[model samples]
Target: MSTLEIRDLHVSVETNDGPKPILRGVDLTVNSGETHAIMGPNGSGKSTLAYSIAGHPKYEVTSGSVTLDGEDVLAMSVDERARAGLFLAMQYPVEVPGVTVSNFLRTAKTAIDGKAPALRQWVGDVKTAMEDLRMDPEFAERNVNEGFSGGEKKRHEILQMELLKPKFAVLDETDSGLDVDALRVVSEGVNRVKGNSDIGVLLITHYTRILRYIHPDHVHVFIDGRVAEQGGPELAERLEESGYDRYLTARA
Candidate 1:
């Protein structure tokens, strides 16, 4: 079984004022087939944790150990991380101006799988995944995330998760900018992956709405870059009712 572990993670970033600390000390573990939701207020370092795990160069790991099944994750490059079965659905997926979606997916798949996928089966798989996401078949020909709506871009992210089938997925604010219907679709796609694969999920979001569609096995409240509290789904219910005033007050 695959597991992702974050131990005493401390991360910082370069700002106008020089290296400012973001994640103070985060320690969390996600086992196979588990979904963990990280809920927090803005600037609480939720996104920092996600980006740090994905090895974004913008964030510096001051002191930490991030490992996947005892393998050193911090030592791997971005592509190496992908090939090693870690996935990050970015908060804002970038637009690849000239590359078509079809080409991009194939390339990514090839890079991760260590060889090119057979064209016929690969095309069929892409088509089926797009259809399942309710995307237009012609969208395969469009440039990645170019001229697409917010929902479409989010859907494309899920499409990647479904296709790539990573061991652990870090989704950063994926529910943002999605309408109710779009949220349901995206959540369903996530659930589909969870049910079909033994992958772990680290879902980072400020709101609990998406939790209704994709049930999290564990809920964590992130405050000032550290996990303040963790519990079962009931914690999310409490969060929905009381919001984060208590945590903010305590932090202040």
Candidate 2:
């Protein structure tokens, strides 16, 4: 089984003042075929952890190591990390003007696989994935996220996860801005990807709503840039009722 391990990951972001510490000695591990939900209040460093693991330049790893199946992940470039089976669904997907969704997906697939996918087969796969995600067939022709709504952007993110078939997917607040129906649809898309492959999922969110549709095998509560508590699905249920008040108080 493939494993993604983060050991004492200390990360910081450069600000006007200087390097601002974000993640302080964070540690976590995810294995293929498992789903881990990270829940916490705002500014708890959830997104920083996600970006750091994805090799985002803004977050610098001051100390610690991230490894995927024994390979050093912190040393890899952003695109290199993708080819190594890592994917990040950004909290706010950026628009790619002039690049149609169809073209972008195919190009990304080609890059990851190191060769062009068979045109016929790739077309069929894209069609099926779109249908499964309840996306209109015409969506392929639209520029990526240019005129899409928040829900559409989130769906597009999951669509990439479905098509690219990464080994591990870090979804940062995918549930944000999604209405009930959109949320269900997006969660189902994520579940489809998980059910089809042995992909590991690290879902970061502030609420238990998405967990209702895509149940996590483990739940981690983040407070002040560290994992304050972790448990099974039951922990999520507890968070739903108690919120992060206890963790906040403890941090204080």
Candidate 3:
């Protein structure tokens, strides 16, 4: 089975003052077919960890290393990371004005696989994935996230995950802004992807609502850029009832 390993990772971002540290020595491992829930309060460096793994230019890895199946992940470029089977579903997906959803998905698939997919099969796959997400057929022709609602953008992200079938996915607060129905639909899409493949998942969220739908194999609580607690799914249930107040109090 494939494995993604992070060891003592420390990351920072450029601020007006100077480089400001965000992640502080995060260590974790995710194997294929495992789901790890990362829960934390706002500004706790959860998203920073996600972006750092995906090789976002804004988040610099100051020290430590990230490896995928023993290959160095921190050394690869963003697209190279993706080609290496890493995917990130952004918390706020950006709009791509000129790119249609259909074209974008196919192009990304081609880039990752190093081969253009057959037109008929690619079209069919996209159509099936969109349908599974309860998306309208016309959405295929729409420019990516241009004038789309927040829920629509999140659904599109899951749709990509389903179609691309990555080795690991870092979903950065994908359930945010989703209404109950939208959340259910999106959650089902994520579940469908997981059920069909041995895809590892690192789900970052603040609430336990999404956890109810997609149960994690492990749960991690982030406080002050460090994982303060680690446990099984029961930990998520405890966090739901207690919230992060205790953790925050301890950190203070």
TM-score of every candidate: 0.99, 0.99, 0.99
Give the Å shift of residue 102 in candidate 3.
0.7
Per-residue CA lDDT of model 3 for 108-150, tens digit only, reads: 9999999999999988888888888999999999999999999
- Give all candidates' CA lDDT scores: 0.94, 0.95, 0.95
- For model 3, the stretches where C-alpha displacement exceeds 4 angstroms are none
Clashes of each: 0, 0, 0
Q: Candidate 1: which pairs clash?
A: none
Off by over 4 Å in 1: none
